[model samples]
Target: MSERRVLGGNQHALPASIFADDMSYVALGHLHLAQKVAKKEHVRYSGSPIPLSMSERNYPHQILAVEFDGSNIKAIEEIIIPRCVDMLKVPTKPASLDEVLATLKALPDDELPREQQPFLEVHVLLDKPQALLREKVLQALEGKSVRLAKITPHYSQREQQDSLQHRRLSEVSPQQVFALSWNKKFDGEPTEAIAEAFETLLTQVEEQE
Candidate 1:
């Protein structure tokens, strides 16, 4: 019987002391998938009981119940729990906003947990006029028990590149381009003076390195 060691499922092997005669079961965690390690029968990993992200939507949520016989491992049982939250990734064009809202409203409330339904991440693919999809979704879900975890807006680099192509080579300074690009990608006012200062500091540090 080894000392009970809880570890991530992605890790390999149990310590020698964990398998000692007087030791008990080793309960592991993480790796979002429940599994037994080796033939020892006592080492196990209990995955997340709920799907915390869109990538884990297919995984069943469960809890592990282990019974120990004194200092020896007896039986390990997996208990499946009903999912309290549902994670959905819906891709929509700008024109489909109304339809998307309708679909979300039509989702069965019975399937959702009473406490709070899982967070939903909406991926918006804008093919038409620009609109604040994030603000719209947040407003729609407001007061509702369900939480809108995030709204991701997808943009095409080709469209931006094509727009940039119209600018004359002489008109597009590297510093200006950098400032424009950085300001667009990140939320904040970026000034040429600040950019110059950062560049000076970066060059000084690089020289030291």
Candidate 2:
């Protein structure tokens, strides 16, 4: 029988042998956190040169500079790149989209990453985003190295509503109601066989107790 394994890190996963090679250099993608994967000296991931999400706000974005000699690793260097995306989560009030665009446009050309330089991704978080503001942001970043990955609005409000609803439902103490709500709100109903299997497993656990 063949066995399967799962690898987890930085949102992108691949087979164990993906990097097992004699190549002069291995450049990995899908990870915002850039680092060398093996002690082989040439295998490295050039993390996103710019901040793509709020989780990476503190991480210093950089690129990898490597020298290869025909299937052999020579030297590896990391070049610090400029910030192209401004991932800010602020209230949508008062801060119009034009204001945000102006702020970005006003940034010195040196501050903005060049289009031919490298790949860049940016995410802007807002409490409540306006349609006009979003349009402006898109227009400003068009053709630039910067691209908006997400624009979340009213995040706190949605979380609060869900929390309140869950708490209220839990207080009723109705098993059937809870089951229905859980299936409806979170996970949908399982197939008849799957549900029966789970119930049997639960009964066995209770009997053991």
Candidate 3:
């Protein structure tokens, strides 16, 4: 039982008493992190045995072994599962593309089996788009003991706003597109009357289609 959200909806925890007092054990699922319900020793979640996503790389995976003595639990043991492959996030903190490339180049050069290679995630801080970014990153990662996972690029708030200004025509709403044209031609926002007329015409056009 968990007092956690489900599918974005709030959910109240099930009463631990829902399990009969004499029941020796209760196993549950649907949660990614292993936990004991209401701190009850007999209730448990085993969680996932392997990393389901890079975000879950740090979750402790385990299998619970239970011993029963005439229908009552005599012992419960947690057996930790060993990690099969490593997950590496380069430049753990977001950094410029150059710094990310440098870190990738410095990764270990061991010639391990393909299945043994660690999974690599590149974290980049972007101020502006750079040409040949994928190619440059790939070249830097050559011979590294890792399998390239994906590149994650993020921008500062100011830069993100500036980038949004150049979004494609289809990505902008009709009103926003009209506002852009109006400003370019008149260097000011459209007057209320003009904006109302435009919206009326836009509605009529939409109805026709």
Candidate 4:
């Protein structure tokens, strides 16, 4: 009665409390990543047979076969499942539409079965919807064999900086706006030296005016 947990085939439904020190082995699902839960080797998730998310695509899907010696777990073996349909991400993270389109168009054709062909997930960093957006993506994939499963448009940190740049100077504080501009240029926070430099420039401009 130590390990009251059983193979949870569904995702995210397995409660951690079900795993106890006395349990010989546990098999769980719902979480897409193969991981040891609660720091117990006997407790684990087999993950999905195929990656359900873009993040999980790098790791191989596995099946766990657990052996028990008396009341203790002997060993846990992993059997890798061959991937049929691949899940891929364009531009990896949220990127400009142009970069995403270029990645999609550059994808080499894979002569697999239509059902086994890779599924692409495009992540675009866009502040607002563009005209004929889906059409543009479809056009890019015109000759590609990959299936366009999802097009996730995200408002990224770069987009925030761009928005600040477009805003009126009177609408935002000088320090805040300048920091945003600095982040946009450097891809990081403004340093103390940069802040002093900005302040010095502001003082000079004010005196000149």
Report the lDDT tens digits of candidate 1 across residue range 94-129: 225676666566555544455566667665544544
Cα lDDT, all candidates: 0.58, 0.51, 0.74, 0.71
Once fitted onto the true fold, the runs of candidate 2 whose alpha carbons sit more than 4 angstroms away are 1-13, 38-40, 84-209
Candidate 2 C-alpha error for residue 35, in Å: 3.0
Better of 1 and 4 by TM-score: 4
- Which residue pairs in candidate 4 collide? 3-23, 11-30, 12-30
What order do you get sorting by TM-score, best first?
Answer: 3, 4, 1, 2
lDDT winner between 1 and 4, please give it: 4
Model 3, span 1-209: residue lDDT tens: 53332223323446678998788899987555567877999998766677665655555678889899998999999998999899877776778988898888888789999999988878788887777888999999888778888787766545654656879867856866676677678976676457656755654343223
Q: Model 4, residue 199: displacement in angstroms? A: 38
Off by over 4 Å in 4: 1-21, 93-95, 125-128, 154-158, 161-209
Q: Please give, for residues 86-178, the per-residue lDDT of candidate 4 as tens digits.
A: 787776556789988898888886566789778887878776767887899999998788888888775555666666667887886676677
Clashes of each: 7, 1, 0, 3
- Model 2 scores worst on lDDT over the 10 consecutive residues at 1-10
In model 1, where do residues sit more than 4 Å from their true spots?
1-22, 30-32, 38-40, 69-71, 88-102, 105-114, 127-131, 140-145, 154-209
By lDDT, the candidates rank as 3, 4, 1, 2
Relative to the unseen true structure, what is the Cα RMSD of model 3? Answer: 15.4
For model 4, how many clashes?
3
What TM-score do all the candidates reach, one by one?
A: 0.48, 0.37, 0.66, 0.59
